[model samples]
Target chain A: MPLNISQPKRKNAISLTPLIDVVFILLLFFMLTSSFVPWRIVDTPLSVATDAPAAPEERVNVILTLKQNNGQVWVNDEVLSLSDSSVFQTLVSDNGDAVFIIQAEDGVTLQSLMSLADRLKLNGAETVSIANAFAMPEAK
Target chain B: MKIAAKYAARKANDDDNMVPLINVVFLMLVFFMVAGQIRKADPIPVIPPQSINDTRAATDPNIEIVVGADNILYVDDVLFTVEDVQAYLEQAFSSAVNPDAFWVQIKADGDIPLDSLRPIFNQVRLAGLTKVSLATQLEREAK
Candidate 1:
């Protein structure tokens, strides 16, 4: 018995393999290049000297002196540990409308200062400002 | 004829098997396209400080000031000196369609010393831009 083999002729058939390949590559690129980390913002209204209204006598000034290596936070003359949240809580409650001036000492990072400011804001302290030791001369 | 019919059926079954895979890949493509924010990479990548403030930066400010870990400043991807930052910002402010609506965002490295950033802040203030935002990441809780 002899078998005659004939190839099947298919009309206008397109392979889905290439399309799938391209889609997979695009998915991989998005997965790797995209950042999942959420971004937040801290709104700061830069106070001009002349326009800044004079501080009321009743409003307390809480100076947060930050040092490097997670050093103690000095709120005014009293020293408090960075981890002690209750102290900061009470401080904010006592002076609800206090102006918190975050004074960063030498070697202190912007991270530490912002973290402290965040904590203070969380504790209900209003008006957090950075104390500029090297205050640049006003634009002449 | 029977063998050809069997081969055609097999090919149809193989194509059917890929339907689910194509569906999944298409879904993933759509997910990334919608969920991910495609932002232009900053000239100087800054690891923003973490904060509890979850307020999303609503508007994409016209100006983005990046402060690198080395205290270098880049205003809108252009390298700028401490003195030049104010000038650039002022010019941008003046030329803006809505000066009041025009704002600045400071994306400073988390580890950068605070004193180094003071100058940048001063420049923003001197530019007469009352609205400024400091870009930050969500503070991760202790694991």
Candidate 2:
């Protein structure tokens, strides 16, 4: 007796195009989500007299300036009205180890400045120095 | 004939191996998504105190608090009560390896009241973390 044998037939080839597309899509998703972190900036006012060339070592100091216009207080150029919530508490909470230098315009009112100093001292700031903007002569 | 048939069989089997690549991609996707979920400091709008001295280098990975025009308390952008802040700091200080090395920076509007500022310091003391700093700007020299 004779036996007959048959071989299996192959037809389809695996396609790589779809796999590459999925990999790229995942890469793009991660890149976009990671960049969403927000950045913030705050501005304060500086006294004209205290505005002078600073030595390199003194440049890193954080300065807080105050000015008053028509009984309204401006802190770091941002107007602070009593209606605003506890903004002072927020400031104390965020800055842990920074040095604060307060520079106020002459005749602006010491009551506000002194009050700020007292608060800063209470908030654990080691030094809250006041800069006399009027003590120095006006620069040309 | 045999060699040609073998090559064709090998090519057909390669398609099934693609399952591993798909598994790897999914794993990486899950890892990154979890990492992104961790809470980070929120950008609080603050008028950073300026200084005439340019001696400070910008520090990284520092916690930020924003004092809005309307004196509200915020930590990492979340509105927090004074007591809440105190509780939070207590936990933070307790976990720190060295409370002395851990610092808290405060950026306050120059006009904020002294009365409102006292409780925060009391909280800092309660936390036992002594190092603290205030952010300020340098007084610009006259032109």
- A11-120 per-residue lDDT for model 2 (tens digits): 55457768668776876677555533222222222222235776566323456665652334455567655233356555555666566676656444334564455456
Model 2 misses residue A122 by how many Å? 24
lDDT of 1 by residue, B49-72 (tens): 887778897788889999999998
Candidate 1, A90-112: lDDT as tens digits: 98888878788777676788778
What CAPRI grade goes to candidate 1?
medium
Q: What's the C-alpha lDDT at position B1 in model 1?
A: 84
Best by TM-score: 1
State how far residue B87 of model 1 sits from its true place (Å). 1.5
**Model 2: native contacts recovered, as a fraction:** 0.04
Off by over 4 Å in 2: A1-140, B1-43, B53-62
Extract clashing residue pairs from model 1: none
Cα error, residue B138 of model 1, in Å, equals 2.2
- Model 2, B85-142: lDDT tens digits are 7678767767867554566665555455433544554455455544444454443541
lDDT of 2: 0.52
